[model samples]
Target: MPESPHPPELPARLLADPEMIGACRRRDFALVFRMVKKHAGIYPSMIARRCDLTPSRVGEVMAAKRKLLHMDVVERISDGLRIPGHLLGLSSRAWESPPELSAADWEPPSRPTEPPGAHSLPSHDVGDILASVACTSPRASTVQALRSSIEDYWRRDDQHGGEALRPAVIGQLRYVEILLMQSRGDTVRHGLLGVAAELARLTGWTHFDARQFSQARLYFGEALRFAKDIDDRQFMANVLACMSLQATYQDRPTDALALATAAQDHARAIKGTPRVLSMLSMREAFAHAVLGSRSGAHAAISEAHRQFERISDSDSDPAWVTYFNEYKLTVDTGIAHARLGEAEIAEPLIAQALHREGGTNQRGRAFHTFWLARTQLQQGKLEQACHTAVNALTPASAVASERVTGHLREFSRQLTPHRSEPAAVAYDSRLRQVLPAGVSGPPPP
Candidate 1:
């Protein structure tokens, strides 16, 4: 069969079943495929044709011998099989049901309630969010509403972590993408594109914090695409800077350096604001530090400080770059020094970062505290390091960040030599409750 224009929709009854909902929620293709065959009479070959999977792959999935994880593959399954995207932990699918209209929930300037994924709101269906997009006449208002919702999502992600926010965020992004497809006027289309870009970037950040690197790259790439479509040079630089940061985190210093440099090249074209330049400069510094180039790292870090000092007014800085202020700059500088093995220099700056970071920023605290502990250890202050590592446990346990957890594991391994010391024993007791049973201390590198 030449691929059907759209996959046939499932019976209304199958779509509403609680078991099917639960399976989709978990993204369990095994269970989902089995259910489809049993109830919908859609055999494996038909599934292969619709979802663009080979017959063997479908057989393996049904036999519990394969699992689907890539974002693109997941998208195909969602769109091809007529599944609502959010149910499968995705954004709204392309083939979502016809404009099932509902009132847009939040008005402009009002903070949005928490989204689904446990902490999420009760009503997260994309139909509700798309209600505003139907107002073609008031394009500016629609764009403004989209921007406001994104701002709220960012605030919540910054205060907590992004793991729980993915479902809602991706849901919004999908609605934006769908709107972008149908947009008419240049002004409204550009506005929607900008909104889509920001949402994609935020979604990528959520994935990055969870240590889901592959998925993060895909969304970041999507953000770049949206930004380029609008010829938004500044936004492109911003996404490049973000990609550079992700590369640095993954220990791909060369790729990180190239991406950061490309972003700085774009800065000349855009005449980027002081804060944006500083943020990009710091990304370069991170790559330099990873590459063991102390001179290069220090030069970029100094430039970061210099550009940041030139800021005329904090008011003019966009929300995207506003977080790259004093505290963030200090933390990044300290992290660069720590990577260069200058623990004495790193300790003070990291301490200040931990001190200035807000109480609600649990994930940030956990991350900074992990670095602080490591720096203390590098100075041979075993007891102090142990105590500092223990301090991170409180915040780390409270947040659902895989990156922070990995840092804690690395810190635990550093304490293996002091495993019997009194302070270390105290830390061990606390860590036991926080980490998995068999992984309190990871195998040495």
Candidate 2:
């Protein structure tokens, strides 16, 4: 299909304010679908299938009859149709509840503590330093250094700066923002497009780190759109892969598969680099495994392995795909196999993965531990399973992923036969400690 024409850029003033930019990012389908129909002349059926939605449902969304949408559905339509999400007015921050009180009503209490040594700079002093840096260096490196300085100030400030740091960060962000805007202006230029996409992705990661999924999704969607616009299939695949991970966390395996499949198809159609293809295929395998399609999952996984084998030390993969390799793929495969009740095969793969130097992310380690616990439970090793479950619960409690908690809940159910045993008691205690209120006990035997 021919690519859709890029929309006219928003005015500089409009993009200056975060709120206005956010609103522009969260566009409504009423507008987007109309534009799609006008530009591509594609019927609703084709759009629905590409987006994995029923034609009727697409009609509802297009008609504005439905006010709510699943994130994956929005992502699928955006990516599949090449519609920039920012044009749809989908801001990540829009979903948050409004502040409870006006600024005047919520006056700050008098500070009792002394100011920290590093944060003692007067507002004027900080402003002057920022101005000097901007005047001297117009490049991104300088802007980033200034941003880092402001962040350090915020971190060290005892006062929390109220609204003080806002203006400074906004200034630094403006410099970086200009760099991104210039890059976007030359969207067809490969180097410019890469810079713009990287900026959006980093901004999205910042939101993700702050536990703002809604905002994170918007930035990620924009990054994905720009990546595709530039015909950077590898970056596009990476963005889709991240979206698939979000779907898995949200407990929507079907949506995950749809995203992974799109990524895989795009990778293959574009003859993407080996590393990109491998990552996409691995995601496809994971989605299939989640849906209990064992043979399909195994085939997809084997394809991924084959692609990885084709890679050479001299060939460079995208920076984002660096974390994916034999060890990670094996762990993912083991999780899939365990879910399929192939404990004998799953256990050794998982053991090997654990034996390797796992990544530094505590949450990932906790998830791997949970998968191991599941494998043990399936093998009827109750005591061993319970021990693994306790380890999983420790780090799992620190992370907000519902998938980890769900797995622990399932393991608890599997241990019901020995509920009164010491290991079962310990497992139940851990579950109670981590689970939300009113979560019922596991299903009866």
Candidate 3:
């Protein structure tokens, strides 16, 4: 680890005082800096230079004008002040000598009352005598690594199936939860929770795709709680939209519409970015279509499109919702129309969407192809539907998604009435030879 650029000449008296550690744990940076100024005669500008932050930002934080603590900022402060990471609810700081803790310093202020299995595990000391291990303090780099890991797992879940990455994501969630519990300072605490919320939401999505509805709901709820705590309306609305989507998939149109509406209402109340508004409106369209409200659905979809049009790629947006685009809107519009039984309208829209972007998303291609096939079948184009369904199988087979399999199963059911037809016969034969088991096909290869 690199040495601090501006190590404070902290006196032994100040270092030994429990109040200083208590202030750190409480995230009283202003007080902490005041103490530094009093003892070491260092000014905030000097501190800012040492911490690699702009003087204005440091001044804002000290004056309590800025309360949002980011992980990078926390690392700078910890490194500069020579504070142990654990003192501020962080893991052990790798750069500095571990702070000496008396027995009184080791105990937490208080423990929350909770039933067995409901409480968090005890916090581990950096060098616990019982554990005989040295834990490094959490670094800004560590948070960045975790964010990258989550993104990789997300991409893996897209290409592969949730089952392949489920255990690992769950483990990551637990690890993040531990970090949230242990992290002290505002910057690190908020940053860890923000990342953890995203992880929870991703875990919930994987579970939902895997048909683990109960587990999916649990994680979504966790994500929502964290988002709420952080006052992140966009993330909170996003989670609600996910829940709405799950409800729509389960055929609970009323619940889906309610959730989506709640999301939209909250987004508006927060004056969220156009991208956020667009996402919520799109979700509302899905629910409206599911409920057989064609005009309402179309209106919501149009609003979504308008909101999306207002957003430019260069505009500042949250990382999670950056995937939204014109092509996605087209695909969603097609889905909404399909749900409303407008096959003719849906077919062209879906075809256009696939033509433009199908090559990029294997899972999405499988999903859209299944829908296109369904729409063809709805239009009585049995031969064309069979071909489309066949095109879907390869990507569907490559992924481990229960939702994709469900689509294939529904397609099979629609094919049953036409089974005696030559095209249907060929499809069945091909499906039986190629598709995974329990969906009227051979087991996955």
- 2 or 3: which has the higher TM-score? 3
Candidate 1 residue-wise lDDT, 1-445, digit = tens: 3766866888778879999988886668999999888888889998888887778878988999867754446667777778887777555654574554323323344456543321122244564666555543537888999999998888788677899899989888767766766788899988998998898889889999887888888788888888888888778888899889887676567889999999998875878889989999999998998777999999999999999899886436666887787999999999989988899999999998888787477888888998999999999999889889988888887877777776876677667677778998898888888765644533322
Q: Tens-digit lDDT track for model 3 on 214-266?
A: 77887888888788878888788899999999987765578889999988888
What's the C-alpha lDDT at position 319 in model 3?
80
- How far in Å is the alpha carbon of 417 misplaced in model 2? 5.3
Q: Against the true structure, candidate 1 has what lDDT?
A: 0.80
Residue-level error in angstroms, candidate 3, position 45: 71
Residues 199-313 of candidate 2 have per-residue lDDT tens digits of 5555554444333567667767767866776788778777788777666654456888999988887777867778788878878877887666899888988998899888888
- The count of residue-pair clashes in candidate 3 stands at 10
Sort by lDDT, top down from the best: 1, 3, 2
Give the Å error, residue 180, model 1: 1.6
